[model samples]
Target: MSPQQKALILPEKQGNFKVGSRSIPSPGIGQLLVKVHSAALNPVDYKIQDDGIFVTHYPAVLGVDIAGIVEELGEGVENFRKGDKVLAHGNPSIIDQGAFQQYSLTVATSTAKIPSSQSFDSAATVPQGLDTAIAGLYGKHLGAGIAPPWAKTASDLEPKYPIVILGGSSSVGSYTIQLARLSGFYPIITTASPNNEDLVKDYGATHFFDRHLSGRQLMAAISEVTDSPIRIVYDAISLPETQSVGWGLLAQNGILVLTLPPSVKEDEGKGRKAVSTIGSPHVPYDEEIFRSSWAMIEKWLSEGTIQPNNYEILPNGLEGIIGGLERMRMEQVSGTKLVAHPQETK
Candidate 1:
């Protein structure tokens, strides 16, 4: 094996990405060195390049969703063995662990083995998006505080409650929909482009509305579906307009969880609240919660409880990621994740 690996490197803050060489890193205790077979693109990757957010160093490597084989396991890492297929949530804050490279080191707690039924491309689409959903739904201080469905003591009785998910066609939104269903949230409602209505529905959204629907129109449409209080609204888009819509639909005391910063003004003394979520498990407070959720991923995928986002493989390997991220920035990627194969970089 080459001592160095090809990586798509951002040479400076707000700089362009280029295929460059980087040293392969070894795993630390409680971590694993993974051969990244497939990497999925996200909006945050472009946002980092354009806005220079999250990363403090020059030549930053950015990407968060990865699926591959475990090449080496660090001390105390008992869950995965070398050569086992796995999917992990990449931590872009650390250069050696970023997903834009052919190999990366990942914390064992945030990594899960891929079930035999899923492919690397499919599993690559799950980590960041699914973790965001988990964080927003279950992170005690960061989320809506719903009980996780995978808990052994969890009640299987279906709760006849309503949950609204904004931007259901997005990678995170789609995962949010599936987790909502698993928690027995009744009449799972979401918004998406009319053409992709079926896609969100297939992910367990009980009802889908056109994304262009006005807040008033969406409220009326959703009201007809169920009069149950809309206690949780997960806004995957979290744009100003979407946040306003979600805030408007939320019942008193309900939480409006946003993937981005809260945009709408809160009503005084209304008891409704808007909270933004930090998706990565590396957050000090969030690791334990995400670790528990990550433990369930393999079973979730194996049983078809959580389906991965539809994906398109971008050409040119790691170099192709630049165009993919650009398309995401332009909002051209709808309802599907764009994936790249780092090993194919030339």
Candidate 2:
């Protein structure tokens, strides 16, 4: 029999989560077998369990943010070696790659070494959020088609262009704010509860507004921050209300990027556009940008160019994830990622 490991499994579509066992998978080419130390929860995790939107297989494991130590490396994987601490965005569609397990396989191209400045729990909060930000900002097909800051011609471009991010305190929103700063977008405007004002500012938001404001009210408020046109509005929350606000704030010929499907209709006469972005590196359209950004993860974290989201560690390890997901569904968690230790599961 192959080696077995503990996993949090969903037995059927929209099924309840339960602790179960699965065999540890071997590292295939260009992959690493990791002993998962921390797995961070996202809104999508509960959505999958509730709506069964992504996974097709039964007895599925679902989680995407992972930070762990590499137990073994597959052929053609040269950048990482055994025992290297790393963080990766897991693919919940694949059972072997799901993060809600004691051990999982990670794609080498999408994995990055975790810098000493970060702990496993903190690092686990980054992969999915950061990838979503990268895809929404830099992906031509999946996002606003903005030029990446790392590109050679990026320095020659104009700066001080204003951008707005709805839900600045969200994991995706927080990373989007940081990357927008690096891309030289000025007067970085964001919306969040007033309590998270300082937190979003630390992430590089130049202007913060109360998220409860209506679309017209938000537009009026943002006008005070910058007279420049708002060419890009990233609705990290992407709820119908937030999308309405983002669409209202976007200037003619501007783009509205959404993590969820757009609720606002685009008008060709106005030349306004709406794009939905999927953050997975495995997606062919987003693969290039994800690889480019993942390459810089270590340096960015080490230099503090990118800061991990605030995280709350869940108790009782993997079993604790159930309550955490429920809290997320109830809108109880705010401005923080929920992390679980799979190895601590009993």
Candidate 3:
């Protein structure tokens, strides 16, 4: 085995990264050492690379969504043994020092075994949006189907309530639409550019509003979709402008969920609940809940009930990280994932 392995290194601040070599990681307690097969990128990567956020150190490797073969399991880890294919949002705690290496370390708790029929690329796409969807839907009293814990099922609680998701064209937004539809929400409404209306609708968005349209027109469009008041809304894009528009569209007692913090929180003519989800890996119990949810999601993907959206593959292996971050910094990427393949896996 080689003593050193290749990794994508973000050596300093702002949009500069290069492929570098580092010692292969060994699994620690409750951690699994994975020979990275492929990794998927998120907008957060470039955000940290250029206009940094949650970065603890420099000269780091950046990637959160990972799919790999388990080379070795750390002490006390039992559910996954060597050679199991798995995917996870490995190490959300730090920026840049994640799965963009030949070998990566993952907590067993955050990792889920991949279904046999799933490809590495397919699995790699799960974590980034799945965590948001799973976390957002958990613990909510929805009229949708009652899924066995972690599962998104049609709830008998209330069939008539409506759920709104802003920015349905985004990766997280698309996932929320699919999961919400599965949960039996009567009307799933979302806002996106006109180009994405068909794509978003394919994901089960029963109604689509063009944010580019007039605010009054957008509101009237949403109001025209369903007579029942909007009860829950998850804003995958939480820009101030979107929130302002969202405020007007929300129904009384409707819960507003944001992917990022809303700039303002005034009650907009209706009693509403506002909250933000930073995609924190769930607490132990909640973790188990999502684990089960993803398990069901995995089944759905295989059974064709759910679909995998766009994936932008970067095939330069770990060496591609720098360029990928550069693209992100320039805001050249939209509605896609930037991913790299590990040259070789043991």
* TM-score sort, best first: 2, 1, 3
Model 2, range 1-346, lDDT digits (tens) per residue? 2499999998899999999888999999999999999999999999999888989988789999999999999999999989899999899998999999999999999999999999999999999999999999999998988788877383568767999999999999999999999998998999999999999999999999999999999889988888999999999999998888888888999999999987788863289999999989977896788888899999999999999999999999899999999999999988999999999999
TM-score for predicted model 1 compared with the true structure: 0.97
Local distance difference test scores for all models: 0.91, 0.93, 0.72
Q: Model 1, stretches more than 4 Å misplaced? A: 152-158, 267-269
Report the C-alpha lDDT of model 1 over 1-346, residue by residue, as the tens digit: 7889999999999888999998999899999999999999999999999999999987778899999999988999998898999999998889988999999999998999999999999999999899899999988888987777886364545567999999999999999999898888888999999999889989999999998999999999998999899989999999999998999998888999999998776765289989899889888766778878888899989999889999999999999999998888887888899999998999
Residue 254, model 3, lDDT:
67
Predicted structure with the largest lDDT when compared to the true one = 2
RMSD of each: 1.4, 1.4, 3.6
Query: How well does each candidate superpose onto the true structure, as a TM-score?
Result: 0.97, 0.98, 0.86
Query: Scored by Cα lDDT, where does model 1 land?
Result: 0.91
> How far out, in Å, is residue 32 in model 3?
1.3
206 Cα displacement, candidate 2 (Å): 0.6
Candidate 3 lDDT at 184 equals 71
Give the better candidate number (1 or 2) by lDDT.
2
